[model samples]
Target: MCVLIKKYKHINTNNYNVLENALTYDIQRIENDLKKNHNSDYFLIINDEGRLGKMRKIQRINYIPSIIFLSEIELLIEDSLPKASKNSRFIQILDTISYIVYLYCLEHFNNSRWANRVRNKLNFEDVINLLDKIKNNSNIQASRTNSYGIVHYPR
Candidate 1:
């Protein structure tokens, strides 16, 4: 006989059903308690000792999959660059990466909830404007560096 069936064989049907429900309820209650005490997020769990070992374990499990997804998006951006005059695809990818970073920040840091609020307030046009400013600054910096005859070494 199955272990569960053998263990519950002495209980009447109604009592068995009640026992099952109680067990489920107790499990959920325990989980809620743990979450409340630990300040755990969807992807991370921090214990009372303030160790992030469990969070690192969870991140390690999903790291490869996240990298693969990011690489695919990078390939899409590279392909779109040749055919589209507007770098909308690149901007979209940048926005997605920013959102992912924002989510990570929210999950990992207790005080970073403001980042989520700021990210929610930003729109596509805001992202595009930020990108334009970044490109202009980079161009100006490059010209200044060139004028100074400074060679940047790859680290």
Candidate 2:
């Protein structure tokens, strides 16, 4: 079986930037700990070291499927509907897709920049195309810092 270790919080955030090599040692140590105790067949060790956030962007789409966050999605829409459907069916689908992408971004980081961007859009359909581009290509970490850098998400 594969072992998933969320080492980001487990490691002290204050030391992460200076502990790159230490993190590698920590991974091997975790693997050994798993093999010795938990599972001998722990062939894969997936570590989410938050410092190396950029590496996860491409692979996150494969693992961050929206099905698992169904309940969260429900809560998200509990009080939230665009005041304009108020528009077309196409607009609705695009809104749904953007919400899904926002949820995906939320998985990686706790920031609400994506939701805020959607909230602050000029019109109901303002950022549909931009949201589509962000869906599978970007991670929330990037979305947070690079807010103004992204297309259509201006300051």
Candidate 3:
């Protein structure tokens, strides 16, 4: 499944009309293409539209960092379970971003062995670093490539 998560600040919703409009457009395009190609992939959109109460608790208590730290530990957890006990949503997002980074590198450096290097060096710290790098690069490239989207239009 391909989940596209948009994590905007909870209170910034009202000011994100343009972002919402662009998200709708991209989601529609993804859905249409998935349908047309008969792909099993799925797209999901997650926003902080109605989670103010939860956000407030985390915000006021400074619990967000602990939650994130727990997330990292979950990714490192091991068991006889069906899959990693990590935050499923976060794992899924990380996987998707990692795949995108590999794809980008494959396309950009046809002869380089960066993918193999990344796979071999995939440790907890390195993986976190890799994810951050990929997320940053993906955001940059996505914004640059999607320049013609509705959000870029002057209202």
Query: TM-scores, in order shown?
Result: 0.18, 0.20, 0.25
lDDT of each: 0.32, 0.36, 0.38
lDDT of 3 by residue, 23-117 (tens): 33444344444555645654443323243333222221121122124211111112112234144676566556646544433333343345576
- Estimate, for each residue in 26-122, the C-alpha lDDT of model 1 and write its tens digit: 2233334345554543222222222233223322122112212421111011110112214456545544544543443333332334455666886
lDDT of 3 at 97: 63
Candidate 2 lDDT, 49-144, residue by residue in tens = 343443333221222212233111111112212234424565566456545544444443444345465467533344445454654433322224
Q: Using TM-score as the measure, name the better of candidate 1 and candidate 2.
A: 2
How would the candidate models be sorted by TM-score, starting from the highest? 3, 2, 1
Residue 26's lDDT within candidate 2 is: 33
lDDT of 3 at 38: 45
How would the candidate models be sorted by lDDT, starting from the highest? Answer: 3, 2, 1
Best by lDDT: 3
lDDT of 3: 0.38
lDDT of 1 at 102: 40
Worst 10 residues of 1 by lDDT: 71-80
